[model samples]
Target: MSSGALTAFILRSPVFAGLLCFFVCAGPCPGREDDQARVLYARAQKLLSEGDPDEALDRYLTLLKKHPRTEWSALSLWDMYRIYIHQDSPEPAFEVLNRLIVEQPGHFEKAHAAQLQLVQRILGSGKEARTNLESVKKKKPLPPEIVVEMLKTVIKNGPHSEVGIQAHYYLAIAREQAGEKTEAIAAHEDFAETYSSHELADDAGYQSAYIAYKSWKSMRSTGPHQRENAAVALAWFIARFPESDKAAQARSCLAEVRAAELSELLGLARYYEARSNPKAALIYYQQIASRFPEVIQTDEVLRDKILSLKGAEEVVGPVR
Candidate 1:
């Protein structure tokens, strides 16, 4: 239709006339360009409602370029991302939503939800990265090397997001499980220290203590008593958060270490006794009884200390 004929048809259409009258002035317009953008945007919404996303997206993009702040541009972009998600193209959806998070933090919840949906979909599909991971698992148990590599990927890509701590924690656990005790201890320590103020601080602290205790226990024969190390780690947790709910746990762990130390002293006493060194055995037993009087084995240790001292005194014929 000719422009004049089309105008006449639009004037005859109640919907078109209503929109024009509501949005456009009857007099000469100084901001006619902006009004034209609004008209296009309204038409895009209409097309989207009518199930014409292709055309709707085209017009929305045009409107955005023409008048980026038409008050509906953010919504337009959000809609585009939603459409991408519905189409099962989550990569682009996540990208757009992530950009929205950075560009408009007030809308971060919406963007974060969208991104989480995309990640879940990707994981649920059992494809891409997830597929490869599943496939590898089917072939053989994941080696320490592979687990570490996977964790590193999450850490490197997820720093600005909440995924960093998760990745690091997983890697640390994987390392510990794979018998890489030293590396696991280091990883847990770093994660707990670096993200102390993060949302995952408590979780990190719990895991750090748990992992360090286990790793140190397993590696004790190499020197530096493992129970002592575990005690030190528990102390760190307790000192850092004195009133934490985990304080009870830390106290229990400290008690275990104290008991272990007493056990070590008793073991040394037994060794001296076996070697027929009554004086040394007596001294070690007395040390355990005196220093660890609150230990669970305190009563037995005190009786042993008395017997050892009496035996040593008889062997030495009453020392002055």
Candidate 2:
């Protein structure tokens, strides 16, 4: 049982000698580091499949750091990217994805395309977030705070990039959907200003005006200030986008606002006339006739009213 006897015995047997040669030539046993990495990768995948993504993410990160050159490293990075996306942390997800694309283009091409498709879907360039809509209806939509964070990331990091433009557009839609009219208008305006040459610029401009008009309509009481704001928005839209598809609608809204102003002036004139203030009533009627001549027959009626008021004042000797 001495070492020399054992070696001799092994060398004397053809089968044992062949097995030893094969083992030596095939290379040393797989390293402990590789074994550890494999075990960790399997555990991470299991944790993810069991709905423990946070733990899975930690495990994957550990594997990547400890076994960077191992075969599992690329796969671990990809899985981590998926988890980040599922958590709505697109910034980190993008980081991981870019790394994967740089390190293993052939392996990650499909994943990169999938990520782009997801972004397009959320931005309504695709089927309008089918999964997201379902999640919303089920009361399980991704956290709004997280979405906001992701949007901010896209805007800040890729402002002039294609994804950034889409992100801006999507942010405006999100604000509108949440009933944040002022915020929506601001976002739309920002997109239009920042990406003037983009195809969506005209649409953004139109949406800004439309949102302003809608806000004006939803008010219980319309005043000069409200009318002025709405009128300005419509006028901007009309002048800036006369050739736009929404131009007709913008012009109609403008006319409605102008008519409301004319009606208001007419009401004031009538009220002054009823109160025996002929001079004041005449001023109002004349103002309307001069300012709104395009109001159809109303211009002639306003002029006639002005003349009658002046006549009444002259006959009454300007009653105070």
Candidate 3:
């Protein structure tokens, strides 16, 4: 049939006009572009599945250009993103994801999830760069504060999402990995308290407490005394997260922290005893005897001194 005859035949049946439009479009069909865009999306997906990414990309770009503000166009960007990612072209893939985030609006739940994945990719880009030892030999680690702010942004944008929960948990891990123990302790505490029912909450709580326990050891030589703080934090971990895998080690470390406290008390006691202040010395001696029997009572010589002190209390408090 000639073009005019075929057009007349198609027009006579509404269903044929509709169905044939999907297969043959001579020019722009303004009112039918929505269906055309939908057809393009489905065609692109099929082409992609058949391993014809180049053709798939062409169809996606055509849809995006003709249907700029439509749902099909928005959906096209994600498939384009997948193609770029599969091609190992991260720059385009990442750009497409960014476009999806900015241009997306409405009940596009999958689009929102993709946006979060972009957030994770961007924040972890620094870590990825560090993975290839030779490539990043001269590169410095991401500043701990910067990593922290990025994760905080996710929590602000999507607090209840799977991404947000992970971001909150990783904020502390980032701090700890960077050796910012003080900041790590603070961040971990926040995660545990804010998301107590989350799967990672116990791990967060344990990290904060463990950092508190480990920090004093390095600081004691040149910094202030933190034995009591360490002991308190570690003991709190055991009580609060008894079922945590790290709790067993925490219990052992609590003993070490108590021992440090005992050593400090012994120092103060000896200082007074050397100056002939036996009564003041007896007070700390009594504290050590009462508070840290596991540490002090094991030594026979120390045991004799405790037994000799008249004002010393014969108390042996077990560590909680």
Local distance difference test, each candidate: 0.66, 0.75, 0.72
Q: After superposition, how far is residue 265 of candidate 2 from its true place, in Å?
A: 2.1
* RMSD of each candidate relative to the true structure: 11.8, 8.6, 9.6
Tell me which residue pairs clash in candidate 2.
none
Identify the superior model by TM-score, candidate 1 or candidate 2: 2
- lDDT agreement of model 1 with the native: 0.66
Best by TM-score: 2
**Of candidates 3 and 1, the better by TM-score:** 3
lDDT of 3 at 15: 97
Q: Rank the candidates by lDDT, best first.
A: 2, 3, 1
**Candidate 1 residue runs with Cα over 4 Å from true position:** 1-141, 216-224, 274-276, 289-320
Query: Per-residue alpha-carbon lDDT of model 3 for 47-131, expressed as tens digits?
Result: 9778788999999999988798777987798778776655545446655765675677553345445544544554463333222
Q: Using lDDT, give the best candidate's number.
A: 2
Candidate 1 local lDDT, residue 203: 57
Q: Give per-candidate clash totals.
A: 0, 0, 0
| Comparison by lDDT, 1 against 2, better one | 2
